[model samples]
Target: MKDPNKAKTERMMVKRTLKNLELNRMAACYVETKEDALKLVRQIIPDGVKTASGGSQTLVQCGIIDFLKEHTKYFDRYDKTLSPEGRKQNEREAYFADFYLTSANALTEHGEIYQVDGASNRISALAYGPDKVIIVAGINKIVPNLRAAVERVKRHAAPANAIRLASGRFCENTGVCISPCFDENDLMCHADCGDDTICCNTLIMKKQRIKDRITVIIVGEELGY
Candidate 1:
C-alpha cells in the first residue's frame, strides 16, 4: 500500500486498540519531529523526579540526556545491567517520576507496540513494571499490521540495533557482525555454548504487551539510524 494509505489505516487501527485499552492518546509535534519531541519531553517531565532508560541512542542523539540533567538529576539506567539495587531505585523513585522513556521498533495500526531489545530490563519495565511507559519511534517505524510490524523490526530495527550493540564487541572485531544472524560470539552469548542463555534477549512484544501503562510517541523524522 501507499505510505499515505498505510498511515491512514494505522491511525484508524491505533485508535480502536487504544480505546480498547482505555489509554489516553494525543498527537504532538514531537510525534513527528526531533525538536518537537524534545520539547514534548520537557513539557512532560516535571520537577523533582528521577528517570530511567534502556540505552536508546536516539534519545541521547536528540539531546534528551542534557535536557534531563538540566531539569533534574535523573539516573539513566540505559545500558547498565539491571541489579537488585537498581530495581529498588526504580520502585523508590516511581512515585515522583512522570514516565519511563523507551523506544520501539514498530507501532501496529491496531495499536500493538513492537520492541526488539538485547536485554530484558527495558522490556520488563515497559510491559507492566512501571507506572507509565513512553515510546519514542521514528516515522519509518509505523506499519499497517502486526505482521508487518514484526517484519519491520526483524529486517530493519533488529539488524541496526544488533550492529550497534556489537560495534565494540569481539564479534564485530572479527570477520562478521553478530546481529540477528547469531554469530558465534554475539554479546548475548555464543550460540554453540547454550540455548537458555540471556544471549537470546532480543525480544518481540505483542498482544497484552500493549496494555494501559504505555504511550506511543511517534517522531516525524528518521531516527535510530
Candidate 2:
C-alpha cells in the first residue's frame, strides 16, 4: 500500500479543490463537525426560526430531531408523529417562517449546493420557499461538482437510501437504474422502484433566483452515510 500519510494528504487535496471551485462559483459556505453543526443549531434556534424538513434519517442519526425538540418552541415536525393540534401548529408556523434547517447532497467548494428528492419538497423548500435556508452536511457528502455529486449519490447514497426506505432484498442489491417496480404496486420489484430516477435529476441551487436564500454548514466529521 502507498504511504498512509500520502493517501490522507491526497484526500485533503480533493476536498480543498472542491471547496475552491464552490467558492469561485459563488456558493454560500460554512465548515463544521457534527458538534459544530449542533452548536450552530443551538445558536440559530435562540433567534427564533421555524423549520420544515423531509424525512432524513441522517439528521435523525445526527441527533438533530432531539436538538430541535428540546430547544425550539416552534418546529415543523412531520404530521405523522404529531397530535392534531401539533400538526396544525406546524403548518401555521411554516406559513411565515424566516429561517429553516435543511440537508443537501453535495457542497462544492466552488460554492454550489446540490440536492435530490423524490417528492421535490426538500429541494423546493431549499431552493425557493424559505426566506433563509441552512443546509447541514457532513464532510463525506462533499464532492468536486455536480457530476461528482450525482455519481456519489448513485454509487453510494442511492443504494443505501433505497434499502432504508424499503426493506428485504432491495436493500441488498446495488444498481443505479430505477427498478421495474418503480411503484410499489408493481409486483416484480420492491417498493424502492423509481427511486434512482428521482435522485438522477437533482435540483441545482446555482440555477435558482433565490440562490442567496441558501446557506451551507459543512461539518468536518464524516456524516450522512
Candidate 3:
C-alpha cells in the first residue's frame, strides 16, 4: 500500500506547483493517474486536429501517442517507412501543427519548465510554433527550485534518455552527467560529453506572454525518466 502521509505531501506540492504555473501565465492541472491524464489530454485536444509531439516516453506511458495516432492528424516522425528526408520534412511540418505535445525534463515548483535537447526541434517547437502546447509530466519530474530542476536533468533525465536513444554519449555509459557536481555558480551545469552530446540545447520557460497557450498536466504517478 502507499503511504498516506507521502501522498498528502505530494498533493500539497502539486497544488503549489499548479498555482505558480498559473501565476506564470501558463495553464496547469494535476491528475491522480495516467488514465486521467489521457482523458484530460483528449478534452484539451479535439478529434482530427493536426498534432505532433516531441520524442517523449511520458506521452507513450500515458498512451497519448496512440491516442493522437488514432484520433488526430498526427505527424509521425518515427514512422519506419519514412526516409531521412521524409522524417526531416515531418519534423519541420510539426512546427505548424495545431497542437504540440511534449514532456519536460524538469518542472519546478516555482513554475518553470526546463528541458534539455539534442537536435533542439522539441524545445524549438515548445518555445514557439504550435498553436497550443501540452506538456504531460509525472510528479517525479517536479523539483523544489530551478537549481534542483537542473540537477534532476543532469543526474537522471540525461543519462536515462541517452540509454534510451542509444546515443553512445558519455552519460549513457556513466549513468550520470560527465560532471554531476554543481554549486550555485554551476547553474548552467555544463558537461564534457564531447561533440556528440545530447545535451546540446537547454530551455528554461518562465513567464509566458501568451497566457494559457501552454497547458501542463502533472500526473500523480511517476510516468517517465
Candidate 4:
C-alpha cells in the first residue's frame, strides 16, 4: 500500500506539472499506473496508423511497444533480423510516422522535458518528426528544475541505461556520469564521458509553437530509470 501523505504530495506535484505543460502548449495528463498509461495511449492513437518509438524501458514496461506492434504499422528499429542499414532506414522513416512514443530521461516541474541520447534518433524525432509525440514517464522522473533534472539523469538515468545497454561506457562501470557535478549555469552537455559516450546529444524541450503536438503522461508509480 502507498503512504497516504506521499500519494497526496505526488498528486499535487502532478497537478502543477500538468498545468505548466499546458502553458507550454503541450498536453499533459496523470495516470495512477502503467496499465492506465497504456490505456490512455490507446485512446490517443488509433489503429492502423504508422507508429514509431524511441528505445525506452518505460514503454516496454507499459506494454506500449507490443500494443503498437499489434495495432499499428510500427517501425521496429530493434528488430534484430533487420540489417544495420535497414534499421537506419526505419529510424529515418520514423519522421513520417503518425505517432511517436518514448520516455523522457527527466521531466522538470517547470514543464520541461530533458532527454539525453547517444544515437540521437530519438531526440531528433522529438524535436521535429511525427504528427504526435507521446511521452510516458513515471512520477520519479519529475524533478524540481532543469538543474535537478540534469543531475537526476547523470546520477541515475545515464548510469542505469548504460548498464542496461552494456554500452561499455565509463558510467557503466562507475555507476555515475564521468562529470556528474554541475551548477545552474552549466551547459546541459557538461559531461566528459569520452568518445563513445551515449550522452552525445541533449535536448531540453520547453515551450512549443505546435500546440498539443506533444502529449506527456505521468504515471504515479516508480518506473524506468
Candidate 5:
C-alpha cells in the first residue's frame, strides 16, 4: 500500500488551498482509524446542539450517525426505524437545524466542493440555510481541480450512490456514469440515463460569502463513495 503519511500530506495541501480561498477552515487533521474520526467528530460538535445530516456512507463508516443520535438533538431522516411520515418530518426539521453535517462527493485542490443530489435537500442546506455546515471528507475525495471534481462525481461517486439508493439507472447496472457531450453551460447528462438520473442537481461550493459558516474536515482514512 502507499504510505499513509503521503496520503495525508496530499489532503493537507488541498485543505490549505481551500483556506487560501478564504472559506472558514481548520487545519487538516489526520486520524489513524474510524474510531479516531468518530472521536474528532464528537468533539467538534457541541453537546445538545440541534444537528442534522445528509446521506453519507462516510458518516455511517465513521460511526457518526449513532453518536449524533445519542448525544445531540439530531434529525436523522435515514433511520429505518422511523415511520415514513416521521422520516419526512425529520427531513423538514433538518432544514432549520443548528448544524448540518455531510460528506463531499469531491473536494478539489483548487478549493471547490462538487456534489450531486437527487432531491437537492442536502445541497440546499449546504448552499444557504444552516447556521453551520460541516463537510467531512476523506483524503480520497480530493481531486486536482474543478473539471476533475465533476469527473470524480460522475465516474465514481454518482455510480456508487445510484446503486446504493437503488435508483434503477443504467449506471447502477453497468457501473459507469455514461457521459455524453454537451455544451459548456450544461454539465448534466441528457444521455440514456433519462428520468432515472441521480445527477439531478449539482452544487459547487465556491467562494464563501459568509465567513466561518462552512468548516471542512479532512479525514485520513478512506470513508465514502
Candidate 6:
C-alpha cells in the first residue's frame, strides 16, 4: 500500500518525513507497526531481485531479512557453509545488489539520517554503491536536530550496541556514553576501545543528488539499538 492517510499522529509524521525526504531527493513512508513494515517491504521489492543487507536488528525483527534470504539472490554472508573466502566474496557482491537494506542509528527531524560504523561497509553501501538503498527505522530513532541526533547515537545507540556485539567499549561495561570526546566539540568517541570498537566511523545522510535512490520506512515501534 502507498502512504496511509489515517491516524492523526501517524499521518502527520508520515507527511513531514515524506516532505523532507522529497526535498532531500529520497522517498519515504510511515507504517503503523512492524507488521505493516514487513508488508510494505514486500510490495516495494519485486520478485527475484538480487538483494543484500547491512547488519540491522530492525530488518531482522520485521522478518524482512528472512524473507529476502528465502526469495531473492541475497548476499548471504552469514551462511556457515561458505568458506572464509566465500564470505568475503559475498560482501563484495553486496555492493552490486539491486537493493541494499539497512537501518539508521538516528533520524533527525531535519530529514538527515545518522549512523556510526565499525567496519564502514554499511556506511559505504548506504552513501553509494547499491542501485537502490532501503532503510527501515523506528520513530524512536528520531531526534530534533543533528546535534541531538549525534548525541542520541552515542548516549543510547552505541552503548547498547556495544554490549550486543561484545565490542568491549567503555559504554558496553558502563551502559552509558562516558566517552571523553563529549567535552570537545565532536560528539564522537576519542577514547580508544581497542580493535573491537564499533565507533570507528560516522555518517550523516542529508540531501542527495539522485532523487529516489534511497527510500526510508519509518515504523511506529522501537527497533534496533
Leading candidate by lDDT: 4
Decoy 1 TM-score against native: 0.65
TM-score for all predictions?
Answer: 0.65, 0.70, 0.96, 0.96, 0.87, 0.89
- The whole-model lDDT of each prediction reads 0.58, 0.59, 0.90, 0.91, 0.78, 0.83
Residue 66 lDDT in candidate 5: 87
Cα lDDT tens digits for candidate 2, 74-187: 455564779988765664555356666766666664556667666455665565565766667777777766667666665566666766666433433655434432333431
Whole-model lDDT for model 3 versus the true structure?
A: 0.90
Q: RMSD to the native, candidate 3? A: 1.4
Ranking by lDDT: 4, 3, 6, 5, 2, 1
Evaluate residue 122 in candidate 5 and report its C-alpha lDDT on the 0 to 100 scale: 89
lDDT of 1 by residue, 41-128 (tens): 8877786676666657778767876776567656655425768688556545543455677677666655556665554666666655
- So what's the TM-score on candidate 3? 0.96
Model 1: runs farther than 4 Å from truth?
1-30, 78-98, 167-212
In the range 121-191, model 3's lDDT, one tens digit per residue, is 89999998897999999999999988788789889998999899896988889898877855665554364
The true-versus-predicted C-alpha distance at residue 80 of model 4, in Å, is 1.1
What is candidate 4's lDDT per residue for 1-225, written digit by digit as tens? 989998798888999899999999999999999999999999989999999999999999999999999999999987999999999999999999999999999888889999999899999999999979999999999998988888898899999998998969888999988778666655444545567778888999999999999999999989899
**Residue 117 lDDT (model 4):** 92
The runs of at least 3 residues in candidate 3 whose Cα sits more than 4 Å from the true structure, single-residue gaps closed, are 183-191
Best of the two (2, 6) by lDDT: 6
Q: Where does candidate 4 clash, by residue pair?
A: none
Estimate the overall C-alpha local distance difference test score of candidate 2. Answer: 0.59
lDDT per residue as tens, model 5, 176-196:
677733335557664566686
The deviation in Å at residue 144 for candidate 4 is: 0.5
> Given candidate 2, what's the lDDT at residue 36?
64
